[model samples]
Target chain A: MANTEQVKLLGFWASPFARRVEWALKLKGVDYEYIEEDIFNKSSLLMELNPVHKKVPVLVHGRKVIAESFVILEFIDETWKQCPLMPQDPYERAKTRFWAKFAEEKILDGAWIAMCSLGEEKEKAIKLAVEAIEKIEGELKGKHFFGGENIGYLDIAMGWMSYWLPVWEEVGSMKIVNPLQFPATTSWMNKFLDHPVIKENLPPRDKMIIYFQNRSTELASRPHDWFRT
Target chain B: MANTEQVKLLGFWASPFARRVEWALKLKGVDYEYIEEDIFNKSSLLMELNPVHKKVPVLVHGRKVIAESFVILEFIDETWKQCPLMPQDPYERAKTRFWAKFAEEKILDGAWIAMCSLGEEKEKAIKLAVEAIEKIEGELKGKHFFGGENIGYLDIAMGWMSYWLPVWEEVGSMKIVNPLQFPATTSWMNKFLDHPVIKENLPPRDKMIIYFQNRSTELASRPHDWFRT
Candidate 1:
């Protein structure tokens, strides 16, 4: 995989978004060179390629730069032709992509809500967190995976919530996903983390806790500041 | 087009999400029977079709139902090959989808920040609004449409922001994309609204002003009670 077809990933190992590409690539068994990026210490390569987002988990297929984790996943799906991320049927594919979006936008961002809220806002955050979980459970009911049996796009898109959110809770000193209240999500998170493909590729829990702890601190310190280089 | 595909759209005229599909349909010249639904008083059919979200801009193509506005746009791109909504290049398509997500999560959500923020949070909302415009302005600098020249996925993704945001501002009596501050975004919004395909598909500005005024009053009056609904 060189010249125009080279598959190289710019990522920080502990990132859930990076983990998303790792799981997909590993599952698909695609050979890609993983370049570790310390996002805080910005690299010229990362800066040039993803000048817009300037975030990691940018997949470079040949010369084409595809930013956005979910977007990269789609490109990977189409390019690799292994471990299909989406269902084959147009309607089913639409359904999977919908939940993929829900996971990214709501469940992941719900962590921000939990972390940011104070007193009364905390209660609202908790309620929204529960709602986010309940929505996922409804989507997951009677299906082994969000894609039903095989782990598909929704599962991969939401894969972070399964593996990383708990680490976020541990580091941020906030407990949003109470197992007692959200047993389905709790169990699913564990089950997903334990799944062999995911387990082998899983970033070390301790490192993630440290990374996300620093991240939460940094974000809270400057809630409005979009990353300054 | 009529008998071949059972294309029916459940939408509220005022909703930007619904408008995404309306514009996509109009751009592709796809004939679809549009059913007007009151968002709060959503019909049983809309609920039955989109049980999970139970939200509008649900596209029913034959018996298959596609929910979420972006998902629907993708579906439309797939179903009707009249005009390709996405890029032919896989990487370009991925980039298009990337900006679309950014538009939904960051750009439009920025508008909501202005809508929802009050007291201390209001300042942060203003910052987010500024960031939103700055980001979009940067994205639109050289490109005629977000997809360049052609109104593609990004244009459809952000279709609502062009008209509805101004309407929302008029209702709330505030300005987010100030002409002097973000001249590029201001001009981009103007160019966007002027596009013939978009111009024809927009909800009547007069009605949208009324709708947004009432909606703004509803939100402003019960600012803290947003979670109750």
Candidate 2:
């Protein structure tokens, strides 16, 4: 089965989205070659595969090119039958999808929050992050996973939070998730980190902190003048 | 089965997204109650069904609520079972999904392009609108519909190009689709607009123009003074 299929992953080490594709492929026991992308000088082929978004974690198999991290997640689940990332029941699948989207729209939507924004911009970003995290905490009630009892699709979609977000919060010098406020979620976070498949695949925490700190500095020093070629 | 199950559609009158839901229902011969939304004063139930996005074109059938216009179109086809929207072949299905997603992402991503943007902003918006249209035009290639000969899932998803975008272009004072540049798509536009189901159910074009114009005005006049609100 592996011999006939040519699977390749194009990614950068520091990207949380790239980490998602890596985790899913590993869980599914799919074998593929990894090609690292320079975070700053992204390759031309990467641009070709994803012309519209032109961003990576692009998964290419045989002649098929799939972009958009969320869409790529779905395609992997569909194309590879071995490890089912989503549930069999369509309703549960819908619910899982809803949370995956909620997690994305909430957490990552505020990535710009703690960036170069200062004072009031910084303040609004913090409030938005707090509100988003509070909403997530509410969704975590009575569930070990976003899909009750076991880690599921939403888990893979939100794999970054247990690791990367803490790093970002540290760099920004603002706390988004509080254990006291999100006790259930905090416990769930520990379980997510403890899972065998995820735990083995997790990135080095110290390295991520250094990466984001450098990124924050670069963002802060961006020129005030805007130009288009 | 259709009579036994209650299907209701929640939408806004002037929205192209709402039109997609209407076309899908009519194609499937699934009778549904259409509830119009005041975009400014969205109802509480609409809020509950779509708590995350809090935006409409929601499909409620029996006890299930589906948001995201693309997902709802697929659900309507599956739930009704009278008319099929997606192609049987997986590759063809993937292509259809890609085009549908392309139309949606570009249009939705460019939502803020229409606001308080003049001179360079208008040029930027037109460039964006043209790029989006050209991609859709490129995909038309040798197919009658975005999904080939039959009007299927992707076409319903791209339904906006025929009815809604013209309204938007009129109100925004810009021309998006260049028929001369895209002959295949130009012909499809005529067929799609003339389809009885689409033609009969569309909100009058002049009314939609007025609706969006007023909304645009309201958004423009708001004091974006960055007042630390």
Candidate 3:
């Protein structure tokens, strides 16, 4: 079920969420026009396509627009049905989605919170982030990846950890996820980063580090008095 | 594709999340055992099945265990393939999942915060909750349900609003949502509640109200200084 419909992805350069969609497209051999969005000054096209969230990683499939990275990944898989991102079995699919959702709701979210705080709050955030990382590390034990041998939904969902996490650790000067503490996760991360398609698509590492360094400084200046939801 | 595997749902009677799984099962007419859990003191079965969240509702299909209402709903739809909860088209399915996610992350989460707060912060939370409701109301315009004429994935995801929300509103003495502000949502709520499957399976209204009232009071007494995330 190959689609000839023009598929375009609106993305920000340093966004790992956007990378998930890009990797899925490349893996499925789907050709899509990629338009990079200026984060500071978002394009009218991006705003128009995703009015609700107004965030990027929006997939324009023919006349239809789909926002949200996970949603786009699912759409890509369903539309292409080749180099399948999800497992064939229902139980396996559910488990894959569950972990992917955990990646979104916990691991990624916790790291973000940790980045946007200072002092005691930042310490607490880092602690929680480590806990989430440890939980995921346990889940990855003895498996090549979260979904077994090949990179799949859970791997794509947690892809950010492969590249962006080091930047986060360097910028914040905190051990968000150490290879020693999370050996399984470290192995999986290296494996994900080394994948041919993923390796080719990732943005330059130096640029990502600088961007997050600036972001961390900006967040540190803000009043750190809010509780985690 | 029906199997003879024993299906059992571990749920707290007053939980709207649990009700989502129950509704899906009933809608599909898949006979399963219902075990009402004591939420305060969870059962070993519930803990063993869903060690990750340790929350209801957990679906046990023979030896397989699945947790999280939205994830379980997707599983049920896939396994049964009867009374489809999701749309057939991939684009439509993505849209449905998008809104269902919005319902979980915003509407339900926002309302929970509002009910758990007091004074000015509570007022702010209520305002945000209403905004989320209004957004959904806009989405619901001219459709009987979020998925159009049929009750689908988005409807089940947002089903908590139809029943649990009213109790929250009344207990909190807040007009967070009403027909004047959310005419479409109100109508949809009535339609959903009137459906035989939903109506028959819903816990007693008085019981729900009391449970929520107690819950709201308990939450209000707790420290209320959390970020919205």
Candidate 4:
């Protein structure tokens, strides 16, 4: 049933959000046609398919188009029953989702601020980013992964920290996720990235560093309040 | 089994997030203790339970505690296994989740800005809020509710708009979800509020207006960038 339906993913190469969908689909062993979107000049198809946000990582499943990476990840999990990303138990699943939302709402935004801002703003953002990472570190204690030996929904949801955090750190010439501060998260990031599916699918690190370096410069040139939204 | 478990809800009276959990619990016919929190002065228990966000809508089911309104709603639905908030079909469920996320991310923020800001910022926020509401209006076209015939997950997720939007509009002396601009959403709001379960569980309207009025004043007096976070 899963094989018969057409599945297409609109993604940008360097987008951690897009990478999440790709990793989920790959883990599920679901066949999908990946369309690389130029985010700078979004394709008409991408805009048409996801008219609301017009963001990448839009999953076109048959006639239905699902936008938002987390939504897409859940769709992929529910649609393809193999390699379940979410936990089986309701309690565990709730715990997993709590952390996932925390990552999306706090860590992601804090990390973005940490990378993009300069001086005092950067200092405040770095503090926020580190605090968020430390919480994840506490959650990861005595666990191989957020899914406990399996790279499940929460791990995939927080997967960006494994790859992009390092890129952001290097590009900004600053550090957030370090061994002393976040030992468990550091260990979890290593295991998460070292996983076969995740290892092979990541964007080239050097290229990502260059991309973010340019993005930081571009953002810095804008008005002080430009990135407030 | 659900009846056997001790269920307690830690919530604030005026919080739409906390109200969501209450509605879900009542709909499920699950008996639970409701503990009201003074959001102004944080309780040690609330802080202990939801240390990360330190926010409301914390559901303590026996020993297991779940925070985040959306996460708690899903947990309640799964744990009770009756009066299902989510759809049975996967695609429909994905759509429900998508709109829920959309409401939380876009409409909530835009409306908050619209309700709280003044002068140019207020005008810009009104535009953004209206645009977000218009998108929901389009989605609600030809449907009695976002959940189709039943007031389901999306409807509940968006329940705040029915009550709070009006309050915000009256308090701010502005409009966003009017019949002329958002006919479908206006109609859906009527049906949603008319639903017995939702009507019974909502925070009182008069109290909410006063609450937001004071809140808007407090926000107005703060440093211009105070609410930026």
In terms of DockQ, which candidate is strongest?
Answer: 4
- lDDT computed for candidate 2: 0.73
Model 1 iRMSD vs. native: 1.5
Error of 2 at B72 (Å): 2.1
Better of 1 and 3 by lDDT: 3
Give the worst 10-residue stretch by lDDT in candidate 2 chain A: A220-229
Which candidate has the top score in TM-score? Answer: 4
Q: List the residue pairs that clash in candidate 4.
A: none
Candidate 3 per-residue C-alpha lDDT over B195-224 given as tens digits, one digit per residue, 9 for 90 to 100: 888888788889877877777777776624
If you assessed candidate 4 against the hidden native complex, which CAPRI class would it receive? high
* Candidate 2 local lDDT, residue A35: 84
Q: Model 2 misses residue A148 by how many Å?
A: 3.2
Tell me the tens digit of each residue's lDDT in model 4 across A93-198: 9998889888876778777777788888889888887888878877888999888778999999999998998898888889998888788888888999899999
Candidate 1 per-residue lDDT, tens place, A29-84, comes to 88789999987787999999987778988888777888878888888887777678
Q: Note the residue pairs that clash in candidate 2.
A: none
TM-score per model over all chains = 0.82, 0.90, 0.93, 0.96
Question: How much lDDT does each candidate structure score?
Answer: 0.75, 0.73, 0.82, 0.84
**DockQ, cand. 3:** 0.82
After aligning candidate 3 to the native by TM-score, how far in Å is the CA of B8 from where it should be?
0.9
Clashes of 2: 0
Tens digits of per-residue lDDT for model 4 on B1-229?
6447899999999888888889988988999999999888889999899899888889999899999899999998898888788998888888999989888767777777777788888888788878888788878889987777877888889998999888989988998887887888888888988989988887888888888898888876441322211
TM-score of only chain B in every candidate structure: 0.90, 0.88, 0.94, 0.94
Q: Is the docking of candidate 2 incorrect, acceptable, medium or high quality?
A: acceptable
